[model samples]
Target: MRMKDKVCVVTGGSSGIGEAIARLFAKEGGQVAVVDVDEANGQRVVDAIRSQGSEAILVRADVADEAEASQALLGVTQHFGKVDVLVNNAGVSAVGDVAACTPTDWDRVMRVNVRGVYLMSHFAVPIMRQQGSGTIINMSSTIAVIGLQARAAYAASKGAVLALTRAMAADHSHENIRVAAILPGTVYTPFVEGYLKRHYADDMEGAVETLKRRQLNQELMTPEDVAYAALYLASDEARFALGTALIIDGGVSAAKVF
Candidate 1:
């Protein structure tokens, strides 16, 4: 029960890594707010958590929109009193080379991956500052530290995310607000699987193997693997960690294997 009585807000919690994080947090005793734009998927996640007797609420929000991000937090506060952990996990992707990417596509990624992080921290910080303690976890990718084909825009966006995490940490260190980013390598989330099936091959087996080959482990990490890392950051166990970009990419980023 590391998060006993704590209230956690996880954006994009309807599925994939975000949903996994939300479920684990609730199991560990955090009052969870599952925020996502998809009402059906969002409610499904909440219902599953409730079935386990956890206190979970679903809120719809497009975090790239400042008004919506703020309102989502307000909803969390209205129900749970205050948020102790904020996970900016909502993101969209674009597939284009560095110089060939459209400004519009790049801006869209920035709005969500970068701006959303700011919006959540901007509003949640005040609530945590008054309490003199809180945790912020921003989702990044191993691509932030390494280059990948068709990932120029994504890398840029997530790189900004890593920088934002560090900047937030420096700004709030004295205030007891811990900010960090998680860089997961090739994770087998619905997002990743779908991306592979679309781009790599029409066959599921080929798609999976193609993605796995890029990792040094020759395997893709599961959503639960990332959820465990996030759980550690959200709990009191990571009190001393700030402005750190934690990588869980199965040694892909640490080697030239990719």
Candidate 2:
């Protein structure tokens, strides 16, 4: 019941980490808003949450678009009366070193991963300020702190999110607004599975094993693992954790395997 009666808006909530967060929040007694561009899956998640006797609504939106982002927030506040938690979890990834990453690909990644956070926070902050309390969780990545093989664009975008989280905390913590970032490492989401299929079509198992090796536990992290971290941050228990980059990376950024 950590999130009891809290109004949570989870972007990208149709699947993966975002969906996990939405469901967990609802199970904890929070009224949830599932925001995503995939209307079908979004509706499915909302229906399932309701079937379990939890409150949830699907707000279809592409977080990268300012108009859509603003409308999405408006829809949530209209339905829920206020936003107690805003999870900026929607993001896109690109694979390449700087030279290999095209300008178009770089912009696309920035739009969803960086600008999406900015737009969502821009709208959510004022609402929270008026409410006199709220929590904002931005989804960063371990790649933001350490270099990865071919994640130049993604790394850059997440790093921006981390920086923005700190800046936001500095600006709003005194106002009872908590802004924090979650740095998760290689969660086994559909997005990652798709990446594996595209690049390692003939050796999916090997690719997955390689991913596990990067973590100290030698096991892939799950979306639920990250959702739990978000749950902590969004709950009142984390009130003292302002501007925190809660790392749930299974020790990936803490040490080298060698």
Candidate 3:
């Protein structure tokens, strides 16, 4: 019960890493607000958490939408009374390098990955400040430090997240709001699957092999691995840690694959 009686909000909570985080948080006795634009999936998460005898509510929202971001947080606070942790995990990624990526795609990534974080924090920070204790966990990527040839949009967006995490930590340290980001490498989510499908297609299996071969570790990281990382940072145990770029890259970020 590390988070017993805490109120947590997880963006992109419908599936993948976000879903994993929400479930884990609930298991630790936190009341979770699962926010996502997909009502069906979001409700499924809420029901699943509830079935486990944990408290949860589903808030359907597009993380990229400012109005929706505000409404969702307000709705959560009104329901739960206060926020103890915010996990800014919603993001969209497009495949294309700087040379091939369009301005629209770039803007889309920024709006969701970067601006959405700001919007959520804008509403969440005040609540946390009043409470005198809060944690913000932003999801970044290993690509922020590495050159992922065709994922310029994602890299740029995550890079911004890393930067923003640091800036927010500095701004709110005195207010007792701790900000941190995680950089996960090569997570096998629908986001990565889509990239493989579109980019590799017939050669997808081979691409996966290549990716594994590139990994120093034998296994591809799961959403739970990242979820545990989130749990650690969101806990009271990690209160002294701030503005940290917690890397869960499994040594991929440590060596040169090329």
Highest-lDDT candidate: 2
RMSD of 3: 1.3
Per-residue CA lDDT of candidate 3, range 1-258, in tens?
A: 998999999999998899999999999999999999878989999999999999999998887788999999899989999999999999999888898999999999999999999999998998899899899999999888887788888899999999999999999989999999999988777777887898799998888887777677857778899999999999999988799999997788798655
Better of 2 and 3 by TM-score: 2
The alpha-carbon lDDT assigned to residue 48 of candidate 2 equals 92
Q: Root-mean-square deviation of each candidate, in angstroms?
A: 1.4, 0.8, 1.3
Tens-place lDDT per residue, model 2, 1-258, is 999999999999998999999999999999999999999989999999999999999998999899999999999999989999999999999999999999999999999999999999999999999999999999999888988888999999999999999999999999999999999999999999999999999999999999999889999999999999999999989989999999999898888868
* Candidates in descending lDDT order: 2, 3, 1
What's the true lDDT of residue 201 in model 2? 100
| Runs of candidate 2 exceeding 4 Å displacement | none
How do the predictions measure up, each by TM-score?
A: 0.96, 0.98, 0.96
Candidate 1 local lDDT, 108-163, one digit each (tens): 88888888888888999999999888999999998888888887778998998998
Best by TM-score: 2
lDDT (C-alpha) at residue 194 in model 1: 72
